[model samples]
Target: MSTTQIASPRVALVTGGSGGIGRAVAERLGAEGMAVAVHYAGNRNRAQETADAITAAGGRSVPVTADVSDEGAVTAMFDRVQETFGGIDVVVNTAGIMLLAPLAELDLDDFDRMHRTNVRGTFTVSQQAARRVRPGGAIINFSSTVVKLTLPTYAAYAATKGAVDAMTMILAKEMRGRDVTVNAIAPGPTATPLFLEGKPQQAVESLKNMAPLERLGEPVDIAEAVAFLAGPARWVNGQVLYINGGVA
Candidate 1:
């Protein structure tokens, strides 16, 4: 959709905006003329670069930092955005961590750490979005296609995303009268550092062929899906969009 489609300036908070998919989402929203908050956890410089890119494109943006799992910090992040852009109209919770391990080999500490940022972080951010996002706004949470793919070494990561899926469905119901749409985007085998970090070359090549598209998903591919939900897809609430190029 064109930037002109947005009648008024909408504000968006994109968590993990320093990272691959999150950066794409932030930039896409900015291009749509939304005042964007490029959120980061530790990579302040990268987040600033994202914000700078948006501003250079003649869009309004700022870099904000917060630990998504911390309610107080998340709340503060929201306040900072509101103070800067007036009010939040969209929230894309893309701040997540992925640790791959076979179920039997996964350490409890790894499981807990992964869940802390993935599950708890999404919940905390969604909770704030539920209360703070304006009417006609949206809450876009991130899930993974692994939930359905049932990948062997993705047990813990998939479990966290499963929790996200459940929360998104129910949150939509809870927002019935609020006019705020809630949904999740599940992307399959995206080409991001998080996905490629420890994977062997052969394994990566195998995953690329899983989809009929014959390629790993791109960050922009996921961002395009987010743009739809954040802007024009008002009737598409409570759905889990699987944007995996026919990979079921």
Candidate 2:
């Protein structure tokens, strides 16, 4: 990892920094002068690519692989972070899985997968952050606007994000005197591979135009918001900021 004379660079661990929103979040954190730990569950190649870009541009990053659902793995991931970067000052939980199906038709496998990552994984990472992150550090969690929309076929996914929103508020209070902040970002229809997979071109365009902004969100759009939450958003805690382009 690289260092500067002005201040010791802060280390950030971004879970799911392999692709899509996670990639942009890691890059944005790097640009903000934070040494990042780009954590991925299985996609080391993509994680390394993100880390390499940061290091190449004079910032520093390390790619750590761990399944957040596994308590042992999450612990190991944090251990590695401390070993490599001295300590973690921020943790962003971006690793989530979405399973969309009506309540009745929902497969138990899909339900378990989504809950395991979106809910349990969030808790696992947040616990580590609570225990490991230094005072004045930040924890940023991802929620989704679908929770607000209460959309069909997103029952289980919405429930998980609901859990996230609740956790953010509670965790913020738990860190009351510690100078730490916890917040959840609920984004609308972002143009990530996970969301844009296999849609017809016309249907994609229609969905794009559904938002008041008239286009699907770019990764930079969400990244900019995340950067603020991780840096300048000190007073904003225990709140769910919706970056949905005015979509309900």
Candidate 3:
């Protein structure tokens, strides 16, 4: 008699998996043959939809929830992923909030909320990922092209992403001997609910025309980049990939 052994699939925990970009990334990774933990802050149904889609595609997925800025909650999210999938190989931090206003007029409350979600949330998730992601794993964080474009009303949001850039670089070095990679993806003008929420159609068209590609990014475009970094781009570490279609 002949015997064969099966290898376990890699597992991914995608924060904000209920949202547009996050959902695309979760599904993309799931299609790549990894079990996925789809995380949402509030909308459990949407997260479960993402998971269900993955499962329907003949992949493994589960919906998990947490407030990314809360350390205890984030810890439990990781625990849940591990309990469901056995181990984590990749973590994609797409959970963030954007509040745009001129630097002088930006409300302090808005700043605090943005900072908590974009910066503290990434920090909390990165901390846990730093401790737990297995060897040869990857940690992907979200940044924004506003940091480079220096858009006037985006000062507060850009500041948060700048912090993420700093943390990503340092974390890559800190994981020096661990064989894990840390990187950030800075996407420009993606047409997600978050980006399109408050903008007028004319303003949206202007943004679309700004890019050399003459179009706003799709969530799948960002997901494609995330898939590359999370899977094959092992040497592409400690870097911020600007996926802006030359808008900068």
lDDT of each: 0.94, 0.89, 0.94
lDDT of candidate 3 over 127-237, digit per residue (tens): 999999988789999999999999779999999999999999999999987888999999999989999999999999999999989999999999999999988888899
All candidates: TM-score: 0.97, 0.95, 0.97
Flag regions of model 1 displaced more than 4 Å: 1-7
lDDT of 2 by residue, 127-152 (tens): 98998887667899999998988878
Instruction: Write the number of the candidate with greater TM-score, choosing between 1 and 2.
Output: 1
Write down the RMSD of candidate 3 (Cα, Å). 3.8
Judge candidate 2 at residue 213 and give its lDDT: 79
Give stretches of model 3 more than 4 Å off: 1-7
Residue-pair clashes per prediction, in order, are 0, 0, 0
